[model samples]
Target: MNQLRYSLFVLLGACSYGLHSSLVKLTTNAGYQAEQATGAQYFFGLLLLLVVVLFTKRVKLNMKQIGSLLGLGILLSLTGVFYATSIEQLSASMAIVLLFQFTWIGIVIESIYLRTFPSNLKLISIVFLWGGTLLAGGLVSGHMDWMSETKGLVFGFLAAVTFALFIFFSGKAGKGVPTIQRSLIITAGGFLTVLLFVPPTFIVDGTLTGGLWKYGLLVGLFGVVLPVILFAIGTPHIDSGTATIVGAAELPAAILSAMLILGEQITPEQATGVLLILIGIVVPQWRSKKATHPKKVYMN
Candidate 1:
């Protein structure tokens, strides 16, 4: 039952995150600049998180942790900017594939930091992930423009690096702090980081109009508040490695949502690539399960 609950949590979290990129795409198409949309999402997210913190009595911030949280927020904001910008240049499906490269980045970084090597399963999965991404992005689908491809590739890699940094720093900041408080601090950092770009005429120009506010509020509630709350509640009960793998589901979810909801087409090659990536993700879990239960003896 606990396992079932955890699986549900993971599924919900992945779906929320997956749907978020589509929302960003929609808002951007609806005449909101990338900066404005991103900024509004985080700002409203922070506001919602604060309200939760207040009601839940989880408002506590250690001064000592402030520096780390601030730094993390700045990094995350940059990550958001790069990702949002990439969405403008690349298809949501392609952009998501690139962004999910953070899984490999995280594994490499952790391995180096711990002075250890990745397990055989992890190594194989990493290889499969890159290969799958290339196929999924339709890199082989006829000639590509050198400049556009180069830019997309660079931005994609940058997105991965920055995302990995966000995860690393979030983990660091989360320690010794209540989950809600930690999330609030990080959200605050993201908000302030975006606040720096809030134009002087933001108020006078009526950029934050009623409709924008409504959409922004919705984005904040679903994209930020709900995911954070769900992940926080769920992660404690799940193994970190398993959680990370489960989270990868967001990649395909984003891609499929874009295809179905936004009318994006999925090429045959890309579909095959998606299947490879899924295999890559599943194989590791399968191996781990086998290793854990070496013999499946019948139970009476």
Candidate 2:
């Protein structure tokens, strides 16, 4: 039951994350720069979580906890910067497929930490994931925009790496901290990290006045606030393998949002690829009936 609850929490987190790109695309199309959107995202997200923290009781944090949350916050900022740039440079669908590379990357990280190779199932899933990626990326459709594609791939892969690190360390660190408290501290760290990337003039200038808060609220809630809190609450309860596997839920959600909301075209091939990837994701969690029970024999 606890497992089911946590899984649900993870799925909710994925759904929130999936919607992120679509909303970001909307904000960017509305004439917001990536830096502006990103800066606003973390800034507003910090404020929102700060409010939540104030409402809740406070817990004392030691230096170790402070350092861990701050480091994770830095990675979170990298994920946002790289990912939002990828979305701006490429179609949202393609950017999402590339970012989903975190699937295999997470498996590799897990193997390194545990000093073991990936299971046959995980390796197989990786094959399917990449296969889906090729189709979902519109490369097979001969729609390659190399100028944008090159930049997108670079940033998208960076997003994947940073995001995988965020998941790995977030799960392992700050286990003793309260979920909301941890979320707030990490968001504060993210806010500070983001401030470093954008120029001082950008934040201090009048740019924040023009309907920025509306988009900021969306990205802050879905992109930063909910996912951070949900993952923090749930990831610690499961192994990183399962946590990353469940994180793939963001893939289909992103693709569908791009197609439906952004009006990006998805071919039949890409649809099939999405199905295959879903199969790969589910295979790891499947428990075989035969493995669960065995027949008993009695001899006279």
Candidate 3:
């Protein structure tokens, strides 16, 4: 029952994350620049988190822990910045596919850090991942948009890298802190990074007119607050392999959200590619044999 509950939590977390792409697109369409949107997200995200922390829990972190958490925060902020910029350059669907590349990138980073090669299952998944990326990206179908694709590829890959680092470091840091408290500190770190990248004038001007608040709150709710809290709580309960498979839910969620909310086109080839990617994510984590009966056997 506990496992089931955690699985559901992770699923919800993925869905929340999936909603982020469309939300970011919406914010941009509402006339906010990418930096403006990203900055607002972090700024308001921190404010929301601060309120949560003060009312529910007080975070107490040592200097070393603060340093590690802040490092993770920088990576998190970079993901927001890069992903928002990427989606601005390309369709939400395409940008999301590129960002989802972080899954395999995380695997590679893990392998290198552990000084070990990927498992055969992971290698097989890698094949499907790259193939799906090509098909979903429209590269295989010769439907590429040269100019936007170039910019999207650059920022999307950067987002992927930063996302991988965020995952890696978040796991390593603040092992002993309570979940909510740790989340607050990490959010503060991201807020700092956002302030560094986005000019104060952009954030100030956006806030003064009250135009950016709705989008800021939206991004804050979906992108940072809800997903972070869900993942922080649920991920600790699941093993790495199962967690990885479950996390793949974000890809399809993002794709579907783009199709439904943003009216983006999803070709049959892209659908097939998405299926392949999902299959790759699941195959390695699947159990090869059924559970054996403990006390009874059927007669042949």
Q: Which candidate achieves the best lDDT against the true structure?
A: 2
Query: What residue runs in model 1 are displaced by over 4 Å at the alpha carbon?
Result: 1-14, 87-97, 145-154, 198-204, 230-245, 287-300
**lDDT on C-alpha atoms for all candidate structures:** 0.68, 0.80, 0.74
lDDT of 3 by residue, 98-191 (tens): 7877878878777777878777877787777677766665667675564656878899989988876776565567777777778887888888
Question: Which stretches in model 3 have alpha-carbon errors above 4 Å?
Answer: 1-11, 84-98, 143-155, 206-209, 237-246, 287-300
Q: lDDT per residue, candidate 1, 92-155, as tens digits?
A: 5567667888878777776776678877877787777677777776776645554666677678
Quote the positional error of residue 29 for candidate 1 in Å: 2.5
Write down the RMSD of candidate 1 (Cα, Å).
3.8
Candidate 2: C-alpha lDDT: 0.80
Candidate 3 accuracy as TM-score: 0.81
Ranking by TM-score: 2, 3, 1
Residue 112 shift from truth in candidate 1, angstroms: 0.9
Q: Give the C-alpha lDDT of model 3.
A: 0.74
The full ranking of all candidates by lDDT, starting with the best, is 2, 3, 1
Clashes of each: 0, 0, 0
TM-score leader: 2
